[model samples]
Target: MRRRDFLRTAAVFVSGASVSLSALEFLDPGKVLAAHPQLRWAFLVDTHKCVGCGFCVKACKIENDIPLDANVTRTWVERYVIKKNGETVMDCPKGALDGYTSKLLDQGKSGKVLVPDKEVAQAFFVPKLCNHCELPACVQVCPVGATYQTADGAVLVDRQWCIGCGYCIMGCPYGVRFFHPVERVADKCTFCYHRISKGGNTACAQACPFGARRIGNLRDPDDPVAKTVLNQRVGVLRDEYGTKPHVFYLGLNKEVR
Candidate 1:
């Protein structure tokens, strides 16, 4: 069998391992923490290669059954354009579902966008989703024991148990969580839990044409992510909050949030 197919089969067996720790630090020093950190699956996003195509976003919606609304999103790409003067303008038109050229603009009284010209400093796309933090704030704030972190480092929710309090919504600093428009429950990315557990890649990663996104077991030294995290210049969002997120980025501009 192929490596990924084999890994998915392995994951199915490992899924039986109970992830009983509370949100983050609840696991003892050695319990849920893998003896080899690389054994756990991790996600990576190469911002430099993402073309704001919205393919990943659209694939995620179809794979996970997320209802599409202008405001609700499981994953979205932000297009950032920085001017020479250091002023930055950003927008994500319909989550860039149709790609990021000729994006929809909000024309106010002037009926024209006042954005900087294309001859600006730089531009790039940064995709956003639940970071599946090692110490997730969303799990900590869920009053109903609905939001949870899996043993394999995925942050998820028990939709049936979620009370729609939106507390987790407020607790997530990354702005990745939102109240589901139709379901009325708190919703966010789950790292494609269903497929990954069966050795399949998350839909977003599978759909990325440029190979900008990926998931891999950090423990396998041969896994590309294993070396990339150690050698590449990578960063995660909101490190100041001490989230210790598993998701990482490459070519992250200082202007991105």
Candidate 2:
């Protein structure tokens, strides 16, 4: 049977949400290879294009069977406000599942005194995810070898083999890794491997109406996303770590970390 069709029939539920059992193939050893062996996957985020709508976060939860009310998520958006005095404030309320409507800074959220709009220099939203680095620290630190990177550059946690030791969580510089609330295994972004393998976009990318998020095969010369990455100036998080992150950002402000 076709992989997609078979996956549908093998639906499994986690935390009352239905997910395809086959979608977690990295858990099944010897099946961790990418569907498109020649493709090197990468992700792009346009900071200017993102509007803090949180649609991506909501769609990711539904597509991945993550509990809606869970405090953790595979992806999240952060709002950064730069004060005229050169101080920066960052906050992500409930992983930005609800759209950002508040213009005023919340002391409770940012752990600082509220700054009047007149004192704010600029504000923007940045989406965060597993960078799927070329040399992923999560994969390097997985004692049981539960965390690994697929050939196409997607990082996945083998839920069945994960010992819940939290080593991978601590190893990640991006602060993207977390223990699955239900499974208690190391969990992070998979780049929506299940959907991408079938020639579909990541749930977050698909749900984004503003064209803020995109994914593509970096090896494909004809791909628009790849061309953009090759031609345009893009920034990545924590470049000093030397993990060589695959996720790139356009119009990234210096205030961002």
Candidate 3:
């Protein structure tokens, strides 16, 4: 039988019990990669289009089984206000689930109160999530092999295998990883893998009225989102880390980190 097919059959029988870390080692992703050649999922964020409505944040929580009141989230949005003097203020209160209703921004690293609108030169919203890097440090730091990269380039955690050592959480440079309050395992965005794998859009993308968040198959030359990344100028957060993050941003501001 083909390797991919064999793994599928093995998974069926193994579903009755927890799969051990050593047993998972035999499932070479490289061999199974041939089963999916044209399915590299990519995500895009248009800063110019995002309105900070928090609809995407609410949708992600509902779709991913995250508690509505939980402080943690699979995705969140940040509001950035740049002052005329080049001072930047950012906030993501309640993960932007309530939207930016308050004119007063939180005192983040700046430790300063929100400046007056007259002093602000510009303002925009930035959405943040797991970058699903091509070279995922989280996967490498998982001592029990709980975190891994899929053939489609998604970084995922095997909750059953995870020992909750917190290594993967620390390994992430983007500070996206967090310990699930209930599951007690490392949790982060999966690019809505369960939905996207079924040929459906992510809840965040589907709920977005402004089309700020988008997803596409990078391997498909004709894919609109992929075409944008290929043809248009895009930016990524913390390129200095050399993680090769898959999430790209359009209209990325110099002040944004």
Candidate 4:
């Protein structure tokens, strides 16, 4: 099917009021909640206070038991610090445990961190993962239907059905999805589906010391995500791609690549 057609069909399937177990039994609601007559969850990451901390990254690796050398990062932070000469720079240490250490080390042994010319200029860290787009590219490109998007705006991979084709990896515009060298299957952030459906928050959001990450139902006006999006001028990455990503960035920097 064409990418647009697939996205439309998937959205309709998820927006349904109820889904039969027989149709969804192959899917693990615990592993990836489907669209049902219930709540939906969305996430928001505040760039204003992220501080490039890799705590969330560490938590994801430890909680999921992902290998230390795996190039397929489920979640990671990118530090962007503009130089005084209008030279914009960015970096993400392969597996930095902490944001500060990664940023400081990026300056090399001299430890001369670059900054913008302005005395009180702004610099921010953006922790990126699967945006869980409403019209997910990964789902559209999955030949075996392994990658799917839940109604709650989460992009998930079915490891059992995955053929290790790596199609989703190429389809994802944000470069979030990756192939697990060991499992030989496609994997990405599930928005911690197991925890969110059971009245809990995602591990990354829960571990955030600055409360920079917030998860909530986008359909609910009272939810923090909804409120933030409504009140702030937030933006999603690669908006022109028409992916309709659910992850919103608060106080996004103009220098965001």
Candidate 5:
């Protein structure tokens, strides 16, 4: 079997066993408090430098041990290209799984091999993942109280308490929530809760080769993330949804569709 396939199988087995390993102890509660020293959690994604390599996706699956058949992708990359005059106009494929090889932009399509346009002057990639909202609708709409915002502002789900009602999935405006097929519960990015609370950055942020993703305490004025939000033209996805997400995007595509 391929290395990735092997890892997937192993992760499934490990996740199955982890279901009963002391919920409170499985993830260190104190680590979250110790990591930042301040009570805040936020992520920043820059659209300009993403290369669409899909490494983040692979890393997330390996790090979280998500099942292969499951569609509960915690992180993924999206490729968007704008065309005009029946020719390749602009393209930006800034995720880890970008299929860019070296072809005309017009030939780019879904699930097919994509080649970057050598002549195309503007093309980039954007990585998409859980925004970890501050006022997450998933947390608010959970009738069973399985989802809740942490002290650091990240929205988290308690698998042990979740009833698999799919309420959180429907409540999310950005469609970031997903139900795990094997676990039979709602799952989403915890900002690598296991890692973040342990004085380590999230897998996606660490996996990024170009430093496209940044995580830090929003409460700290001196932190890079906090300063960027204050000084940069940052944006959040679907802000009108009123979820008040903590994740911010920089250098967003003007023609993103």
Candidate 6:
């Protein structure tokens, strides 16, 4: 109750915490990564099947209890339009939350005919979320040891331990990590860790009306998703970065970053 007693207790608690963490510091994270168990998870996103409804985005925010802010997005959708002029433009205004509609445009007098939106060489919707890399850069760059992966292959941030230094955000090559709007801590999609761990579907996967997203366990011999991944040319984003992400995409093109 006294000031001196309170100070002494605080110092003891801090010292104990330091000692506790020092023990864990020697544990190799490479050991965490190198264990090639027969049980790992994966995700598939089919761009052709997604309608840009934004339901997945909405469901992700609601299920994760993330507030709606202009600057913050845990999941979002982008519309890619490749013009005939060999120019590509992508847009995701408001995360396509209201869904996409016809956009009015003016005709230009550049002597060459302008391509209409519907007549673009290519157009599709890509719903973006955490790639959940096998060798997550965010986890590697986390200075305070607040980010790590689980045994079943999900990357997560420890909210209580995170110091909000933004190192993980910078380390992510996929642009999936962000500083939470209210908490100001590193935040990202955990592939709905709580539900997935309990053998349930992710919010986005369940909310998707068209069945464009599929969650799969590579270890499962009878899973249809595993068969699909094996039969199709599944793609990973930024493969050159060597993140070795668990999430794969169907119909992914060079137009997307």
List all candidate RMSDs to the true structure. Answer: 14.6, 17.7, 13.5, 11.8, 20.7, 15.1
Candidate 3, 1-257: lDDT as tens digits: 89999999889988846767677677669777676677888899999999999999999988988888989998999999999998888888889997887788877666547579899899999998889998888889889988999988899999999999999889999989988988888999999999999999999999999999999999999999999999999999999999999999999998888
Off by over 4 Å in 6: 1-34, 104-115
Give lDDT per model, in order.
0.83, 0.89, 0.90, 0.78, 0.75, 0.83
lDDT tens readout by residue for model 6, 1-257: 99999999999999888776567777677785568666678898999999889998888888987886546678888888787777876777677666666452212343223348666888789988898888999999988889999887889999999999998998999888888877768899988989988989999999999998878887787887777788889888899999998888899998899
What would you estimate as the lDDT of candidate 2?
A: 0.89
Whichever of 2 and 5 has more TM-score, that candidate is 2
Work out the TM-score per prediction.
0.82, 0.83, 0.84, 0.78, 0.74, 0.80
lDDT of 1 by residue, 131-220 (tens): 899889989988889999877788998989999999999999998998887777889998899998998999999999999999987778
By TM-score, how accurate is candidate 1?
0.82
**Residue 111 CA displacement from its true place in model 1, Å:** 6.8
* Candidate 5 residue lDDT tens string, 36-98: 456688889898877776777778877887774454578777666544333334443322333
Candidate 2 residue lDDT tens string, 20-116:
6666656643444444456899999999999999999999999998898989999999999998999998888889988687765445634645668
Give stretches of model 3 more than 4 Å off: 1-36, 108-112
Pick out the ten consecutive residues of candidate 3 with the lowest summed lDDT. 106-115
Name the regions of candidate 5 deviating beyond 4 angstroms: 1-37, 85-121
* Candidate 4 off by > 4 Å: 1-38, 102-120
Arranged by TM-score with the best first, the candidates are: 3, 2, 1, 6, 4, 5
- By the lDDT metric, which is better: model 1 or model 2? 2
lDDT of 2 at 197: 92
Candidate 4 vs. true structure, TM-score: 0.78
